[model samples]
Structures are given as C-alpha cells and as structure tokens.
Target: MKVMRLPGLAFILLLQGCNISAPAPGPDFPTSEMADIVFYNGTVITMNEDYPEGQAIAIKGKKILGVGTSLQALATANRTTQLIDLKGKTIMPGIVDAHTHVFNDRDRFGLDLPGAQELLFKNGITSLGNLFCTEEFVAEMRAFEPLLKVKTSLFLTKTFPCGEIQDSWYHGYPATRTPGEVLRINGIKITADGGTCGGMAVSEEFIPGTTGLGDLWHTQDEINAMVLEADKAGYQVAIHAIGDRAIEQAQNAIAYALDGRPNVLRHRIEHNSAIRPDLIPRYSEFGIIPVIFGWKKICDFYPRSPFYEAADFPYRTLIDYDPDLPVAWHGDDPYRGPVNPFIELHSMVTRTEVSETGALCTPPSWLAAQTIPVQTALKLMTLNAAYSLFRDDETGSLQTGKYADLIVLSANPLTIDPQDIHGIEVQLTMANGEIVYRLPASGL
Candidate 1:
C-alpha cells in the first residue's frame, strides 16, 4: 500500500518469513538395495565345512553377508554392484604369516620393498605376526593398517636402542630392580641372543661370550617380572629364542608367569632354530607357540655361511611331541628371505634347498617326509597362526561374521603337486571386504 515503497530485497525477505520448510527426504536410501560387491563362478573355499566350496559370495560393508551357489547369490545382485567373475579361480582365506617382521623393519629403516610385499601377496599372505616391534613401530603399523590390509601382533623386546644391553654378554653393570620394566608396554620385543649367531664361530663378533649371552640378556627374575606385567595387561609375549639356551630361558619365563593362572595365555618363541630335542615337550607344557621360519633352509642354513648349521632340527622333535601343538611358518623377508609362504611351505614339506645344487645333493626320499601335507601347512599359515596370536575368533578362516579377509588364487594348491605350489599366483587380495592387491593383466 505505497506505505514506504519497500525495496525488492525487503519484499523478498518478507515473503521468505511466510514460507514453510519442506520435510527432509526420507533417510537418503541406498542407491540400490543390493550388495556392494559379489564374486561368482569361483571355487570359494570358505574354510567352513558346511559350505567349503561355493559358486559365489556376496559382501556388504566389511563382512561376508552371503555365500552359496551362484544362483543363490544372484538374488542380491544389482546393476550398481561390482561383480567379479572368477572364471573358476580358487579362493581361500588370506594367508597369514604367523611370524614376520614387516612393521619391525619398517620402523627401523622406513623401508618398504615392493618385492617383499608382492611376494607375500602373490603367495597369499594377508596377515602377519610381527615379531620384535617397538611401540613406535606398532603405532605406525596401526596407522597403516587400512592401507596395508595386514593385521599384526605386538612382540615386545627387552634389548637396547629401546632398552639397555647390546648382545647380552656384559656382566658387571649394576642391575636395576626395575630392569625390563619398560618391556611391559605393548608391542615390546625381547631377544634372548643374536639367534644362531651365538652358536656360530662368529659368535664372538656378536656377543663376546657365547655361553653367557643367554643369562645376560635377562635374568630369570627379570624375565618373570616382565612376563607377569604383560600377562596382567592382557598382552601376548613373543620371544626371539632360536638357540636351545634361549628356548629354555623362554620356557622358564612363560611357566613362571602362567603359574596358577586359569587362562592359557598365548606365548610365542620366534624361530625355534636349533631347539634342544628334550625341550620340545616343554613347549606344549608351557603353552608356548613356536613360530618357525621355514625359509631358514634357503635363507640361512643352506647358505653354508658362518651361521650355517646342518644339525638344526626345525620341527622334527616338536612334531613328535605334539603334532597338533600349533606351529606356524614364517618368511622373515628382506633380510635374506622371500615373503612367499608357498616357498616356505614347499621347504617344510620337501626340506629341499631352493638352489639347484643343494636340492640335487639332498636325498629325494628325505625331502618328502620333511614337509607337512598341503592342508596342514595351509593351516599353519592361517588358523594356526591366528591361534598363535590369540586372534583366531576374528579371522584365520573364511567364515561368516569373520572379517572378509581372503585371496583369490590362480589354482588350488591341494590339486597341484606340492613342488609346483609356487606357480600358483594370487589374483586378488581383499581385507575387510575391500580389494587391496589386484594382479595385473600381465600376471607379473
């Protein structure tokens, strides 16, 4: 009404005051009511007896929602779903390296070799039990978990750089009452000695006195205290004890801490190289898991270097005591080893050297008995390794409700000759329902 000749902006503001807000769109529904991804026409080795081999699988979010015949899975298929036609490839639970040092090396040198990760992935290792990791390295691994698609356990150390002592041969230093106290922290790694180096002629180079290195690393009292602290805090301890002396010390430490405890805590002894035949029974008695590095045949013992020792009984005695004692194989790579579990598995079953000359020299009959069956060896890398780390319930098998951690392989290891196991290539690796490594078309 010509009252004040309202400006255009003023009139629009007045009109806005009378407008009503429209109701929010109904909960922004998923674009399509179907699985985000599906794999079909594949031999899905679910690792579950009920559906061991399936024609297809469906995943939603980070879990395997469905596994069955391809026709059964097609009901949930949609145009938006990323369908993977496997063309009869073999699918198995992602391999787990029960004993590895990915984070440990990365922490020490900030080095990540493509060859190492590729070897592991190509051989189907999705999870690694990292022995000898510092808290700093553990933290870095936690940060990189999503990217690496590798799960890890902390192996606390009680040596220097982070602790005190070099090779555990010194004797005169004043013993702190709280010695090894810091080792109670998560991801602590402790070593009894410098592995086989203590037994070699070069033992003096690493540790001045070969015999005392074991005692000097940590006293019985010191190890017990650290183990008790770790036990109370719900942490598993992994000890690097390759020699018999170190193994005995580790066994004693575990028994001391676990006394009168109802829960059988998981404890691991890294390498278990040159284990005393008598001490084999002590592993099960103390409930200690031995994470053996199978690649040692090619990586160390066969090299015939200063550290080479032909007498080292990798697992014969231990297997005699308890075949089901839960052992896992590892490839301690980037330090004279390859990350391929298949190579290690082959070595375990065949006990043949990777080098042609060594393999030729070894008796063909003996090589056959050394390695475990294909299925059992697979368990060592998956279920047994998970059991060693106390993470079996979460992973270690391709079961519903478990994390969708698995790998697609070119062929079934069980169907092929154990010697030809290395030929099987990992086509795809998935962790948490997400593809992490996809094989290139060239198959390199």
Candidate 2:
C-alpha cells in the first residue's frame, strides 16, 4: 500500500497496551484508618425482630458492626470508610441453599459453569451446603478456598467403592484411610433405590437387585456397624431415602444408632418423598430432621407417577405431626429442579402444579396452610442448613462476630406476591465482607 509507516504501526501496538488519557481515580480512603462499608436507603430484613426493615447497615472485616437507621450507622463511618446507597432496594441476609450438589457436580465434571453459579447467586443464594462430595474434592476445594465465597461443608457418602463390605473396599474409598477417619467424617449418603426406573410406587422390584427384599446398599449388620461407628465419631448420618421401604430402613438405622444416646446429633433423611403416615411421628421422636422437597410434589412427582394423585402430598400431615421437629424445604437441584429457593417457596405456598406438558395446575386448597412462613423458610436455608452441618455457631444468621455472608435483593420478599419472589435479583453478594458478585445496572 502507500508506504505504511513502521513507526505508526509500533505506536498503535503501544497504544493498545496503555490508555493515553486515563480517568482520575475515585476518592481514596487511608489504609491505616478503620474501614467500614455501609449500605443505606434500603429495606433491610434483619431476620431478627430487634431490627426489622432498617435504613442502613455497617459491616467491617467479615462481621456486621452495626445495623440501625441511616444516621445511626453513619456515626461509625469515617472518610476512610466506603459508602453505598441502595436507592431503596431490598436487602437481606444472603440466601442459603440448604441442600445442593455444587461441589459434587464440579468434581464429577471438571468444568466451571458460571451460568450455574450465577443462577444461584443472581436469584439470592449466597451460601450452600454441599450435601455430598468426595474427600479428594473437599481437599482440593480447601486449597482454592478464597474464590469460592460460599460456605461449604463436606459430607462423605458411603458408596460401593469407598466402603468395605466383607473385607472388600469400594473403588472410591481411599485404601490408605483408616476406618476411624472415614467414620469421623460427616454423613454417609447412600442411594436406596433408582428413581423413575424403579416403579412410581415402592415394590419388591424397586429394591437393589432383582431379588427384591434385602438391604439396598449393605447388609443390616454392616449398616448398623457403619452407623454406630459414625455416631461414635460425632458424625450425623444423612441418608437419601425417597421410597417408603427406604424411609423405614433409614428410620430403623437412626433408632439403632441412637439407642442410648439421647439428643444425639439430629439424623437427617434426605428427600423423605414417600412416607407411610404412621412413620410421621418417628421423625420427631428420634430427633430426625426430614428435609422435604417442595418442588417434588408440585413439579417432579406429580408428573412422573400416579402417587401424587393417590395421596395428598401429606404436607399438612407432616407439619401437623411435628411442628418443632425442624422440617425444612429444599430443592435437590440441577438434578430435577432450579436452585432458586423462591421458586421452591412459591410452589410450596401455592401447591401449583407445573407439568412437563407446560400445563399449570393448582391444588384444591392453598397449600399455604402447610407451608412455613417466608421468615421460617429463610431460617431453613440459613440457620437450619448450618445446623445440619453442625456449624450453627459459626454462621447461619447475620450477627456480630460471624462471617459477613449476605446478599442484597432487589425487592422485599414479604410484601411482594410469592410468585414474583423468584423474580427478585441479587444486587450484590458479599462473603467475608468481600464483594463477590455485583449485578450490572441492566440487571443481566
């Protein structure tokens, strides 16, 4: 071409690496001075009765320093502190997914899917309980701890390979590990029966193998030994029991393990989907927490089988039996449901059926009677989830001296329609006082 100048090309390359006209920096705060990040002009749901709907909050170094009116909170703010005006947005403690498979899937499929993480954070989820994971993955997660803002706890699953049956160890279980260490770990998650493939209702064929009537994973003797070993090691057993037979077996296991130990760590039956009405009281009597799936009755179970039609979901039956037994709703997500708690809440409150056929149906009576209040539901995700992991004192609520894990929502969940609850966006997510996710102005 017309004698392209080499100097011009070099200048263009240099310009690409540097901005010739840089914007002035924002006001800087002194590093030596005490720093506090304050948020004002927002409806703050404290979850605590003392301070409900406050105008401002002040946080410093992984803890909430104070929560009060805008003027009161401002008293602690100095020139060194950073300030944010929420413009009347709604703010609440970070959303917690009581039951999740984040780390499980991450380890299974080595991929960082931002969309999956964003789906949880953008919809108000800030903390998660990785209900099931391999010890190897947990060690790996501990290494990159800072980037994963969400609090995570590992629960060991006694699967075929990792567990010993008749002196033979399962494949996944490390051969070098001692039995004591394995039992000392959190819970052991074991699958009772195959879902969908096993008939909609519990039957002999549904049991592990074609034989139809025996222990699904291990013999009763082996299960008893495992449960007792775990119990002695200060571990609470969390079993995945979905069918009626599975529920009965799980209940029996808890009863056997806690025979003499009163008020032992609350054993949890994950996805208590099909329960005999008589067994409802067993959950409370034995200090077993039933983590029910809210989305199951409305969306998952209804379409898949006739069981939904045969019996009313028995939501009222369970709550009426044990009001204080710690019944919490959960979405066993990315498996069959969305990770959005609001979506689970909406379905629970309305009992609105969403079909795979794209048809919508509502139960005869508003399931609201059986549904726990929004505040209680919030606790299920936070306090209850933390309690499940035996880490309540360290996290769960937004309080002084606790980790500053929280999320800023776009709207007040209590005042808005339950259906619109899921629509609320997470404006900001902070874990340990560090901003992890900030929503763009466009709300993308």
Task: Estimate every model's Cα lDDT from 0 to 1.
Answer: 0.60, 0.59
TM-score of each: 0.74, 0.76
- What lDDT score goes with residue 243 in model 1? 63
At residue 5, what lDDT does model 2 achieve?
Answer: 40
> Which digits, one per residue and each the tens of the lDDT, describe model 1 over residues 1-444?
222322332244336451111222111123233567777666677656455566667777776767665544444555576767676687788887776665466433345644345555555776676665544554665565444555555554456422253332212221211211211122344666454343311222233333343332567787777767666655666776766666777778888888855436676777776665567788877668888866544423222223213225446546656887888776765453555666666666656546423342242332234556667777777888877766676667776556777888878887877677755777788877878788888231
Alpha-carbon runs more than 4 Å astray in model 2: 1-35, 49-53, 107-110, 113-119, 160-185, 196-220, 297-313, 353-361, 364-369, 442-444
Which candidate's TM-score is highest? Answer: 2
Q: Which ten residues in a row have the lowest lDDT in candidate 2?
A: 175-184
> Model 1, residue 215: displacement in angstroms?
8.5
| TM-score of model number 2 | 0.76
